[model samples]
Target: MKPICFLLLSTSAVFAADAPKPKPKPEFQYQTEGIQVSLPRADEPKVKAFGPETIKAAAKYLDDGAICWVREKTCVNCHTTGPYLSERPALARQLGMPLEEVLADFVKTVPAEVKPQKETEKDGIKYYGGSWTSIWRSIGLAEWDKHVTGKLSAHTERSLQEMLMRQSADGSFVSYGEVEIPHITTDFELTLQAARAVTAAPAWLSSLKDPELLARVEKMKAWLRNAPPKNDFDRILRLQLAYYMPELVPQPQRDAALSLLSSKQHADGGWCLRDMSALNDWHFKMSDTVVKLISGLPDAASPESDAYMTSFAIVLMRQNNVPVSDERIQRGLAWLKREQRVSGRWWMQSLYRGNYSYITYIATAQAMKALALCDELH
Candidate 1:
């Protein structure tokens, strides 16, 4: 009887040890009122990424921006807004909304969803910045297709074709809004934006198969080869164009660019920003009134490690096959995670404008992607 009682107690202890512990409630960045995310997944995949803390932080940051952006109608800048556009649907799904319905809500905000509100430029281009809109609209369509009908809308087709035509004989497109030239930071950032538009709209491109479009793409790729990158930012964008459009950048150039970027990684495990003069020259070539109005930011720049650029560099490195477990990546992720403000924004200066709202939005959006993508990697 004593032996049997001891054995029974041991069995009970084993069972209790196997019981699951309760998970901590998600610490969202804002009140749990308007937008929310599902409880963190407790599966193998989530663990394989970062632990729950990092993901919850990301959810909070994204949700905080969703309402503000839609109401202000400022989530429209393609360069600053593009990553957020691509990331929103995934966020919607995580919040347990019917993916299709939530995505439909987002589609309503895209430029092509309604008619262009402004008149044609002197160039007879109704969307002087229409090319950038095409990029954003197509990115929306791409994200939407993953969860919905997967069919390209009629407006999307027409919009894409028109956007494609907006490209110039020199294989460049007008960045249009806020920027007067391609050298917003990198001489080729705007050009890379043009390539990114086509690369992102896979469903549209796959369906159309226009030979003329193909030739134009080849021209764009070749143009990149001929056009040298102006700075560190340019160098990375050129590398990314290669990553997205392999046929565009030759193997040697890709290898060289990657080497250059890898070598530039700081000892602290993140990348730094370029000199002030690089951006200040063309960027601050602004109206006196507007310049005076911009406050809480600088007219010059600094050589410092920036979250936005570091995240960007991390993505570029990872896309080129650097593992998430790599020390450089781990440090980069650590740098980004530590830098997040309690309010959920990452600190970074402006290349185009000194508007803190725009600066924080763009940097935080890009950093979120870097962390999320790194987390995705096994």
Candidate 2:
């Protein structure tokens, strides 16, 4: 018989101290785009799993990651699993849907006569003008409306180059388009996603040497080298850049970043947001963001952190070709196996206000991807 111990985990721990907190946002800014971009602040009366007891909590909470205020919810609301309709395809994969279908369905929302300014907002505001359309164009679906392959492609490529060109005098890339101001904080996470896009764009771009593109890449590299010290997301960007362009970053800095990540594991086996007060903005759940951050840990024994974190460690280890046979990995895997619901899904906390899909898909996808490497490791 499988030993089953049922534990209901709350996503937060009870703060023994009394402090007035702010009201939770009804929805995040991306709601119009149909995505859950942020979570509630800690000032809310939501119950969450804190400490080692998290394994048994029922309602797990997560922190919202947005720095700016928006009119919509998180990414989940905007990008449904329908073909040709969703705005963000990376998010569609989280919903386990066909990317083309998702794009086809979401592009219908774009207004006609897309302009560069309309497509990309100035600050934190949502980009309404065919920005979604432009993203799809990169993936070969740019002409979903009228000119899928013609003017839109040229426009998108030009727009991206322009975005890359306007690097901060200090070398960091600026916001892509018009957006809400002082609202979106450009953190390590955003930079990492940007790097991934920059790294992959060349393969998708018709030509690799777009002069403009190479210059932007160089500037991006410079900004990364000069990024604010102690920013976790910046560390991630640096690590990724080191992986992509080894000669650009010194090897010593690479070791230092990984060492920093490995050493920062809290006693509770989680990474808190940069500012303790930042927790207040995280949607009522802290664990969600914590686990997501755990994905960047560089520790060899990270699997021993906790069940949730360990799961993330296993996923990362397999992804990086690191051995996963550590005793901690076995124990963590065993614990998760026992906790798997009859639906075969691992339920934890949602970082934003939405369905369980966000955290579930990310965690599961990592696990699934790692499991594929198990055969190879054996």
Candidate 3:
């Protein structure tokens, strides 16, 4: 009887361990554009139909968020308004939407003169004031100039020059020292975005006659050429840089990078952020259990392929001249078209510490851009 009781007890323990955990309740929720948006979860409703109407809906969603951020926050944020301005102008051009308010707001952030500012310490690391803000503003304004205005504005050029003032002695722009994955986290990633900003504007680099500004540009280019990417995110940024500055990334290196990124695409034709870089690599302060809970991936080793990474991968591939007819590109496009949420936004769980998965804002923006590049927005 005793031996039989012991076996039963052990079997019960095993069953308990294998039981599925309940889905995590959202820490917070709010209404945006009259739709209730909870913190990003894996179970958001997928749209049943996707077409021109859906594209227009997405444009409205993006426009509302960007204009609201500009009016209310009145700040340049990497996850929300920053990515919106960088990507949405192109979509706005296609959809005939208004972006004047947001563009004006960005121009306002550029200062008349670049001056030294005090550094603030967070988590024992000192970050220069306005460094992060300047970098994002440069990228956003440059993209607005490239896609919407067709000529660089004086304000855009001023923003770029101010960004150079924040450049570190090593030629890389310093970040906020927080662990916000795929956005503001590393010096290398920030440097690449700065490079993108400089190159995106038509003939901006060639137009530079100031020896000091030209020297700074050469310094940044040298860092880009010599600085090795620390992770897959950095690698992706480097691949993007290759498009604008081919000499930075040699042909063999570019092919290798492309192959590495292509290999990570899941069977469902999407890319998982976790698969691209380990959670530990991002240095999340939370435990694995808590991170998994918030990400809604309790049983799996990693989160599923998400809209942000999928759209990002698609855009990167397209920039490298991968045609819409390619199998990988087609599959990725299908996944993006099928995954639109009912709110006309693409839901992506934040890789940062907070409950507000604002990364979804950028995800939605990137998704629209990906579709446009593939000629799916018509």
lDDT tens digits, residues 47-105, model 2? 23222233222111111111111122212121122112211222222223223433433
Q: Which stretches of candidate 2 lie over 4 Å from their true place?
A: 1-99, 103-186, 202-206, 264-312, 315-320, 326-339, 354-357, 373-378
lDDT of 3 by residue, 1-378 (tens): 555655666777868867997667555433444444445555879889888778877787777777667765789988878888788766765888457888788888789876655656676655566787888888888888887778988888988888887777667777654456677656777788888889887678988998988988899889989886667877776678888788788888888888988999999999977777655555424456535644565524656888988998998899999888999999998899899987788887766644667778888888988898998888
Best by lDDT: 3
Report the number of backbone clashes for model 1: 1
Q: What is the TM-score of each candidate against the true structure?
A: 0.68, 0.48, 0.85
Model 1, range 1-378, lDDT digits (tens) per residue? 555655666776878867996665445322334653232111212122343555565555555555444444444444333555565543443432322432444455444443433333543433344566655655555654544444666644554565566566666554433542223433366567666656655466566577977776667777776885555556656678877777777778778877777777776667765421244443323445333433233433335576766888787877778889988788888777666654445655544443233545556667766765676412
**Model 3 ranges off by over 4 Å:** 1-41, 116-127, 283-300
lDDT of 1 at 279: 42
Candidate 3 steric clashes: 0
Off by over 4 Å in 1: 1-54, 79-81, 90-129, 146-155, 180-187, 275-277, 280-302, 376-378
Tell me how candidate 3 scores on lDDT. Answer: 0.78
Clash number for candidate 2: 79
User: Which consecutive 10 residues in model 2 have the weakest lDDT in total?
Assistant: 58-67
